[model samples]
Target: MSIDANKELVRRLVEAINRDDAAAFEALVAPEFLLRDAVVPTPRGPAGFREAAAVFHAAFPDFEETAEDVIAEGDKVVLRWTARGTHRGEFLGVAPTGRVIGFSGMAVFRVADGKFVESWQCHDRQGMLRQLERAAACEGGGGR
Candidate 1:
């Protein structure tokens, strides 16, 4: 596919994630898709990808990621994004603090045949954890 096509594919996937459109998420990702990120523990396929999304939604019900930039070359697309959400549910064992959080990250996706085949992502996990920890402390609670 063309570079623009690859970028569009990624854009649609992000939109699907933000909208929590399960069908679109499933359709956009290949059945054998693999997501490599610090946050995902299991070896992931499309279903696993969906599960990861569920985890995020469970923690931040209104989670939204805005793409700041998207660049595509060959079959790979790189996206820089910022995400914000309210912590309303447990996340990775961290109790909900009802705090709004924001973080930035970047992801590189390998698209094949118009489907996401693989991805590698990096995010400000430590910063997020610190923010949550501070919130927890302020609330007279301890963080994990």
Candidate 2:
């Protein structure tokens, strides 16, 4: 696909994420989509991707994702994004703290046949953990 098309695909991905639509997300991904990220567990594929989305949506029902920057070169696209939402459910073993939080992330996707096939991502997990901890501390739960 062309560079603009690749960038458009990434933009749609951000929309799907903000909407928390798994079917919409799956439509843009290849059948054998692979996710490579340190925070995510192994055996990652489209289903795993959907599961991760579910987890996030469960924690932050009103989660909104915005693409701050998008760059495309050949079949690869790099996306920098930020998400904000209120924590109302569990996230990565952290209990709900009812705190509004924001985090940034960057991901590079490889597209083929007009669909995302592979991705490598890095997100601010430590920063999110710190916010959660601080919220807990404020609630007398004792944070590190």
Each candidate's number of clashing pairs is 0, 0
Give the Å shift of residue 85 in candidate 2: 1.0
- lDDT of candidate 2 at residue 13, scale 0 to 100: 85
lDDT at 18, model 2: 81
Model 2 / residue 104 / CA error / Å: 0.3
For candidate 2, the per-residue lDDT at 88 reads: 93
Can you write out model 1's per-residue Cα lDDT over 1-144, one digit (the tens) per residue? Answer: 999999999899889889887898778889888889878654667787778778788899999989999999999999999999999998777899899999899999999988999999889998888878787777774544
Predictions in order: lDDT:
0.87, 0.86
**TM-score per candidate:** 0.93, 0.92
> Residue 99 in model 1: shift from native, Å?
0.7
Candidate 2 wrong stretches, greater than 4 Å: 42-44, 141-144
lDDT digits (tens) for residues 54-78 of candidate 2: 7788999998889999999998999
What's the CA error at residue 98 for candidate 1, in Å?
0.5
